[model samples]
Target chain A: MTSPAGRRKHGRPTISDVAALAGVSAGAVSKVFNGTGRISPPTAERVREAARKLNWTPNPAAIALRTSRAQAIGLVLTSSSPVPEVGAANVGLISGIESLLSPREYGLLLNVFLTGHHDESAFYRSLAERQRMDGVILTNSVVGDTRFDLMRDLGVPAVLVGTPWKPGVVDYIDADPPSAGIPETVDHLVGLGHRDVAFVSGPAGFVLPNIRREAFTARLAHHGLTPHSVSSVGYSPAAAAEETSRLLDVAAPPTAILYGTDTMAIAGMRTIQSRGLRVPEDVSVVGFEGLEVGEWVDPQLTTVQRFAFQRGRAAAAKLLGLLGETIEEDVPLEKPVLIVRQSTAPPRSR
Target chain B: MTSPAGRRKHGRPTISDVAALAGVSAGAVSKVFNGTGRISPPTAERVREAARKLNWTPNPAAIALRTSRAQAIGLVLTSSSPVPEVGAANVGLISGIESLLSPREYGLLLNVFLTGHHDESAFYRSLAERQRMDGVILTNSVVGDTRFDLMRDLGVPAVLVGTPWKPGVVDYIDADPPSAGIPETVDHLVGLGHRDVAFVSGPAGFVLPNIRREAFTARLAHHGLTPHSVSSVGYSPAAAAEETSRLLDVAAPPTAILYGTDTMAIAGMRTIQSRGLRVPEDVSVVGFEGLEVGEWVDPQLTTVQRFAFQRGRAAAAKLLGLLGETIEEDVPLEKPVLIVRQSTAPPRSR
Candidate 1:
């Protein structure tokens, strides 16, 4: 049979041809580029050389059709409110995923699903008709989500950034916002001789809210100390300042406070200084997100370094795995490290 | 003459029917909905009402083919070295544009043309041939860009977020970076008793660099006080801090600093404080970009409030204006206001 205009008379280069040229198996050739399957380093190199020499370009669409995938991945986030923290996080995640997908010839379709932002039916239609993307990476997953259900019913593969209560055999990469990072933070503070600590948390009812609070309480108990109080505030520096001022007014307030985000921590520290209180002496502050602002916030805040970019990379990897690429289980959860700066110290001996 | 669907075929709403129902011309209906013509409010409402009643759906493909315009818009941005500031700015711009396009049933295609980030040719080919977006939005335009040249050669319409010096008649919507915002900031600082002010700018050789520096010099002249110095640094908090530190160590330091962005202002403040100096009392600082963080930074930044949302809206309007709709030149140059907060004051009575 004659080949297409761009192909040789024997038809376009098949996996086998590429494999033979590379001195590797068809599977090894695929895995070499995909970062999966078993292949020696030399064999992998050979496969890449062969493919390049043969001018073989993989058809993503045909592969999608054959593999029953869309060959494109969806990144679902809300751009409606567009808070700075979430907005910055989204940027980091997108860039991270792009780092992986750019080389693989995979396309990312950003599907922002915000109620009241657009005609919901149009977005639904795009997903229902399989017109937009193949697999999806769901960020900020709310419990018992209809979007997740719809994605599942459509048999479209998806990976969640946050844990879903009933993800139902769906793949996911979750951050241990409560126990993993918080306990380590508490231990670090204790090591710094902090006996009285306060907890500042995000708004209540979300998964992170509950998880972080419990972790705070449990970690406090382990350290033979009860938190001065748990303060919950809206996500903003102004809100954090208002809440922190209340805690600072108490008769026996904590010497250190752990903040949910760098924004809040920055505000809290400023508020303490406004009251003429010193950080790490009269009061110490710890923050999450390791925002660059944390360093500029007077006594550079001591924070746990959570890899937002790596998390994004992991999310992309999980979605890719769901698309028939085998990924190893027991994948190492990115451990957050405490970057001790000027913000932490021993409580005053008095 | 019979229509393409045949004479006296079943009643299906056409552009002509929308025109008739709306009590306006067919061209007006096309302009209002297809983003081509400018129609009055009431007349546009009538056309929309008719289209809804008749359940008219314009064939996007046919429209694209006939007009040689893709019924979509391409947003071109860099993906390799993703600048969070630019990324955030683009997000605002994209979301605002989405608001404008969704009502008109136009699809948005986001393309990140990071050199070596992806298979760029395939993406360009698909965007040109398959995706077929009508026009493109090029953000952060560099001088003498090849992207603009290619779009022009392809006969596609384009609207730039920043000014373009490429050969053809290119249209753009840029914040009055030099004259409007940064100059006003200097004027405000000089008015507030800061005689020796410094300018901290983003990378040299960029479009805004020379414009902003000249504006600072001109504004200083207007105030009868020459600036101590102007320094160019990379677009990051760390870089801003390092540059600010150098400026502060000079023999005769500036009493105040004008930063290119809110993040830079925050960093500059920290650099001053690290030397046991206080903001306003020792060295006041001002910044650009009315980002949410501007309000939270300690001694909350006095800066120019460039309405990013409005900028996005204006860019979209300009794109619509280019699509055969007449829009006045004054509509695009919406001036930004100076948001004077607590960051500026009379130089310390030292």
Candidate 2:
């Protein structure tokens, strides 16, 4: 039994061999293989099958010369605000994008940029300078995003994962931040007989928080019960815990607390437990982002199920759509359905 | 205020404009920008300054052509088994790899293979045929991964995220699976007065499980306890719950449960809680894979902490090393330190 490694004695088959077998020039073979330069499908199939048989591989450069397409999509995120845990989201997004790109034989090139940072500006400058990608997908968009302007100005077709301030200028898909969504979450809490509610807002000026805060305040007005308080904290779970602790310790504390993200929700739950306070029994909690970890957290959190994976898939489809591909415009954005678990219930005195 | 959307008032500045100011040939300007076909350092500096003055945005394709290096790294993962949660680890790994690749001006090209019960032979064939990448990195290597062999045969510089069966044939960086480190964890348990410890394994026959099973059994003997039982479960948190319930139903249930993964540990904790059992007091639970969620879980799971990020960094470093960049061989193994949190404690009256 000869090892496959040793048996490959002829060395890697090249395009020249395929050309010889097909009785064509190397350029013709490359054009056929790359499906460019006007080869019939049948003829291209024959060349491909012959190449497969001979183990002939096409040099990507030669293919690049024939097609003039990079055959790649670029994934962009802020380098400074590294979301390590949000990897699942990234993965889900990538998976969704891959589902779209793979069939078309398009590859994905992930590019990370540091926003408002000097060192990372060079990185962004470098990415814009290197025209190796067909389109770019920007996740983690912020107000006044220079990346959006830069990508557009460069004539690079791009899409945003989150809704941008100026919607029409660039294509975007976003989880409804606060206005239409958080009211439903707060309303659900109100339905559960919770009078006073507190909110944990992650990074005040961030799009989601700004939206959530306004929604919470407006919803409180509708209920004729003002929120106990709205607290600001860093994005870290630890920061959520400290903020949650402060909110919980105040006089006339709320019976329900809402969190901007799932990680914060989980922290709030633990903080509640540390005080011998039972979830839903003593206080209720609602979280956003619907993270997978939220399911396993004790008293499995009641959360608005934001479909990041679906959104990622939608973003990929939209980018492809910009490339003249078939796709639906109405990507699902039904308000995050609240997954009521052990986390929310009637107020203690109800 | 013109929306940056209007076609740029002026066309992108060209190398000619830069060359006219730098007083160098277009080729010299190109070579200088590409860091290839280089001019003298002073001349290169002059070209850069002049290009900056003209606000020259070198054509990406032209630069790519002049440099010749693709400035791309192909990251290949099996599309079929991609765990969405593992996206975080993938993110960490990519971020680590990107830290190196980005500095060197290399792009990360992600390839996911999802054939849906179809043979992956075509995927491999296409990859072998394509040469858009300077090198490739294969993550989450499974048993009988033919990629290593294919990469070796192609003579493309490559690195593996998980250890291959033939270790010396390819460079790889991976966590020393808990099986290899089980003795230490088990010893810690024994030292803490634990007996009748039950071992929960990940889906059997995996590389991590293969090592863990042996180490767990051997470690039990070393501690003078016959490792009587081993339970294997699927990788999901739900599987952990089911397995934990079964383990606890026994007439002589173990006093301690060692979970193979953090997800399993959380599941097992839920299982115990559902049975009206208290963790540590009823049956101590220890989990592997010290993710951030572990801290948020009540009883703040006492588990082995493997530096998933550091391991990612090390893998990137090894690839850099293989690329003839200087890196130390004494790359540290991120030991799994047992975080003695609220989850593990001595049995009451075992």
- What tens-digit string does per-residue lDDT give for candidate 2 at B41-140? 6886787677656667775555545555566778776533442233444655676666666545567888776525324554544544555566778765
Q: lDDT of all predictions, in order shown? A: 0.68, 0.71
User: For model 1, what is the C-alpha lDDT against the true structure?
Assistant: 0.68
Worst 10-residue lDDT window for candidate 2 chain A reads A1-10
What are the per-residue Cα lDDT tens digits for candidate 1 across B1-350? 13413422677657887666666777786765554545666676676666656666565334433354434566676633542223555656766666565545455555556645444433544344333356777775555456666666555678877656543457888765435786678777777777888899876756666677888898889878788888888666778999998887778898989888777788888788879999878898888777766665667788887777667667777887777644443434468788888888889765
What does candidate 1's lDDT look like per residue over A1-350, in tens digits? Answer: 12222354567777677766666667776665444446665675566567656666454333323343333576766543432123555666776666555445455665555545554533543343333455888776544456666676555777877666563756777665424688888998888788778888876645565677888889889988887788777656778899899998888888889987787888898889889899878998998877655665557789877767677778888787767665443334577777889988888886
Lowest summed lDDT over 10 consecutive residues: which window, candidate 1 chain A? A61-70
